[model samples]
Target: MNTLVTGRRLARELGEWRSTGPAYRALADRIRVLLMDGRLASGTRIPAERELSGALGLSRTTVAAAYSKLRDDGYLASVRGSGSTLVLPGLERGDHAPGSGLPLDFTKAVTLAYPGVAAAYAAAIEQLPAYLAHDGFDMVGMPDLREAIAQSYRNRGLPTSAEQIMVTTGAQHALNLVTRSLYSPGERVLVEQPTYPHALDTFASVGARMLSFPVSQDGGWDLSEAQLQLRRAAPSMAFLMPDFHNPTGTSMTIPEREFLTAAATREGTVLIADETTALLDIDRGALPPLACFSPGVITLGSLGKIAWGGLRIGWIRASRDVLARILRNRPAQDLGTPLLEQLAATSLVRELPVLAASRSRDLKLRRDMLVQLLGEQLPEWDVAVPDGGLSLWINTGTMSTSALALAARSEGLGLVPGPRFGLDGAFERFLRLPFGHDVEQLRDAVKVLGRISSRVGPDPLRMPLQAVI
Candidate 1:
């Protein structure tokens, strides 16, 4: 079914879209950015030109021209008696394949596969035949794999049992399952303002109303605003990344974690902690998992980032009751996590410490290289060097990264603009540059940024106060 974007909704998404260019072209460019960044999905029907014009208080001619430009660029399709629908040109709708036809794709914040992955898979293959006679649909997880996942939690100081684990295809799948089981339609879901973009996608898929608190690069999580939202909104669920938060690599201090968990518990809200990036630690020492504070907090873990993105294995660590609920709802989405991957994951989980150490050494070198390159080449841009996580969250000062991304794409580089991590088109001046790629690629990406910095004009967009914590 095709989704319809209302005029009011489009206006909210097009926050501060105007720039120092023709209004129509600027509007079209902003829409393209939204589409490319996966905020505004492909194949959705947009509001009519007249409706959008009234929503933005612009002339109908301007809206018409914007729509015309989108059609010209093959980003939209129009049919008589039907509205204009967004299209992605050559790619299928909702396709998230790795390659973007760009030479340098910094859109993903993933790292190279852990070196031992092939050996683990080989070990799994030798062990796979032992279970060929049984039904292949393993709903919960293989017993050994679940135990391995539980042991990982125990190593982190959060006592866990195999019964508390339910493996999924990946962390994203685990999140989807949790959201479906926990979130009620129309109930509010609280989130970090600039969170994992796909987490927002999952929440939006359920049509859940969202509230957000800030996680700034300098000041850390805004607990005051978080408490206010929990107390005021009483949202049904709150999504968080306490350890090595995406975009901004700031982890929550122990006090902040304690307070937030206590606050959510008081408000009767379900706290879901995404720990996909937790194990990607480069230098920052271990912090207690959020689950350590509250048994009710649901924790999601995956090997995708720590091992390889190709290894589709992740598990949810929750109370037995929560696991039971998730298990009951699991089959509707997928029958089971692949048995072969689980066998491989069991071995990988056992060797997590070794993998983490290896990733740390490599990540530190690349992170330092990218930081030095950016500092030397684009000194005007403010960059916060994160101790861990795959990317650097940069403040482009006055340059509009949406424009920067559009310009960079033409130069054979693909970048994700700051607004992709934010809601209501916030963070236009910020950019996320992943340091997980090769040193030469990082150097080249920075060079591209430096070269185009002058051409991408300044944007006056500010974070909307209502969306901020």
Candidate 2:
């Protein structure tokens, strides 16, 4: 018996229904469920896009997109000859946890797309139908979009080129591409302790000799000290989030960036400046890209935080030579980003004001609301009012964030403890809570946390919040 339904099954079930989403996702998700449960055996060919789209009265592009997501995740494989086949290959714990159904998903350091973006995406689709006759894999990107991104960088006082850009699936993909191309497994990689969780995770998975440098809540970094650590650890490469650094929401000065880039350059190390969170800054001025200070740096940027995480779009700005290296590394890990998402992101980038204004209003409100709520409800917790970014780094008096996290998870709250962001459990006394959620949800969450915090004794709360900055 056939397990996962082919597109033919969806055609039969929907029977020329023209509705979008709800119905669209139902068909896609049902197939995913079957594949996950081992019902969808490998080597089964899904129906052709034209056939299914016509049969269900759905746009071919929509079906194509669902297929694209599955393709990206390694769930389905397609080639010029073989058609798509079922292949949910990974066996991982996080995969089993599933998507969030709650009003608040603090774990996401990303913004939800604006309501009007649907129209913008639809516009891209309308535009795509016209372009279908041409070669789709224009690897560098749509030229207009490249020029737009280059302009954005220029606006921020950093010089860039369309040639320096390569559109990617997201910041994660961009970093991974750079990492794979720039350094080999077992290479020494230096990272900020209490850094973006995925960076450490990525470095470690590559079997790199990973070293963690300190970053502070009150003190960002002292150059001389960091230089010593760099000399001592002798890392082959480093990943940085210089602008509005993740989880901690710290921003580096131009001087600091210059010093860091110089130090890394002198040490003969490649600096991967993950600028994924750069533009969300509510701060007063522009902080130029670390690449401005050193030509030898790889910088990652994305539409995720600026436009929406659903865009699944990011880019790497590096020299033309490094771009070639990243291209050679691409096929081993990913083919390339889905063409549709890239198109949508490109449109979104051109409409920069809409995206920036939406981000500014939403994030500013959410950030302010969170600060007030935490102050009112969890007065005992010492939380930093960040300069920018979606999350607040808390100096949780207690070192055992695991206890609070476990306690919170029981109440349907996902707490990303500082240790998850740290290499040596050094941020044991720190905790990260995203201000990305709305006021009501943040209020409720703080109440839940405050209730949990109330029960802990003074001793557990008195431990010095370690600064692994």
Candidate 3:
């Protein structure tokens, strides 16, 4: 079945899309960005021109012109009886690949593997033979791995048990299981305003009605708004990243964490805290995990960031009852996490402190290098230095990152526009630049940004394509 995007939803997604250029051209550009960023599925049917015109308060001719422009660029396909459908030229329908096939792909916020990962895998292989005789289908993690994961939490001052841990393929998979188990058809899910885009995708997959609260780099999480939403909406689940938030890279203050957890408890909202990037600490010391504040908070942790992205090991730390619910629903999606990966994960989890120390040294060096390069090249841009995490959240002031990303692609650079992290087309002027690359790559990326920064100004649509490319 083809997904149909409503006119109102389209308008919301096209937030602040107007530029100094013609409205038709601006609309077409925004739609293209949405399709390129995987915000809008290619095979989905968009609203009719007249319906979209009504939604945007524009004339039908303007909407028709925009649709015509999209068609001319091979982004929209219209049929006589069927509605206009979005399409990516030269790519199959629903083919939203991760990178742009460009050099310097900064779309993902990940880091180089910890140097000790290979040795850990080797160690896991030595121990794997003993467990080879079993069925090896591990829905709830290996006993040793679960205890190690639980002990890692206990090391952080949070009491946890192997009984509370259910291993999964990765943090994203764990989130899928959590959402499928907890979220009903129409229940609202509250999330950070600018959060992990894949988390938004996971929630949307279940047809969830999502509400948002802000988490700014300057002011941190908006607890006031979070409390308001919790009280008013009474959402079933609230997804959070209190430690080293993905795009923003801001960790919540102890007071902020306490307040939010207390508020969620009051409203009976289940807190789903994603600690995927929790241990990516640079300067920031250990703060208590969100699970410490509330027993109901379901925390998701993975080795993908700390150890290596290839290590598909993540676990859900929730109450035993919640684990039971997730376990019951787990078989519908996936059977078990790979046993070899689990064995490797157990070794890594035990050596997490050593891995974290190594990552911290490397990340700090790269983070400082990227910040210095950006300071030298793009001095006008506001770049906040995060204490930890893989990326830097930048405020490009008036520049539309969607337009900037389009221009960057021509320069052999890949960038994720800010709106990809936001809801309702927010954060168009913001950008998340991952600083996990080498010093040379960082220097080249900055040079590319510096070269195109002036070209992609406040009015991205008005920028001459010939000049940018």
TM-score winner: 1
Greater TM-score among 1 and 3 belongs to: 1
Q: Which stretches of candidate 1 lie over 4 Å from their true place?
A: 93-99, 460-469
Candidate 2 stretches with Cα past 4 Å from truth are 1-103, 456-469
Cα-based RMSD of the predictions, in order? 1.8, 15.1, 3.8
Clashing pairs in 1: none
Tell how far residue 210 is off in model 2, in angstroms: 1.1
> lDDT of each prediction vs. the true structure?
0.89, 0.71, 0.89
Best-matching candidate per lDDT: 1
**Candidate 2 structure quality by residue, lDDT tens digits, 1-469:** 2233455554543221221235445456545543432323455577787877776677888788777877876778787865777765643433432114333455567666766678768877877876688777655677767778888788777888888898888889888788878887667988876688778757755778887666665778667777887888778998888878888888887778888988998888888889888878765356677888988898899888877788888898999999998888788887666667766777777777666767767888888888888888878788888867878988867545544554465677666555567654456556788876657788888887878765533333354555445
- Sort the predicted structures by lDDT, highest score first: 1, 3, 2
lDDT of 3 by residue, 1-469 (tens): 6799999999998877887678999889888888988899879899998899999999999999999999998999988899889988858543356355667888888787888888878988998899889898878999999999999999999999889999889999999999999899989999998999999999999999999999988889988899999999999999999998989999999999899999999999999999999999999999999989989999999999998889989989999999999999999998899988888888889989988999999999999999998999988889999999999999876788888887887898888898889888888878999998878888999999999988876654443321100
| Residue 102 shift from truth in candidate 2, angstroms | 5.5
How do these models rank on TM-score, best leading?
A: 1, 3, 2
Which pairs of residues clash in candidate 3, taking residues 3 or more apart in a chain or in different chains?
Answer: none
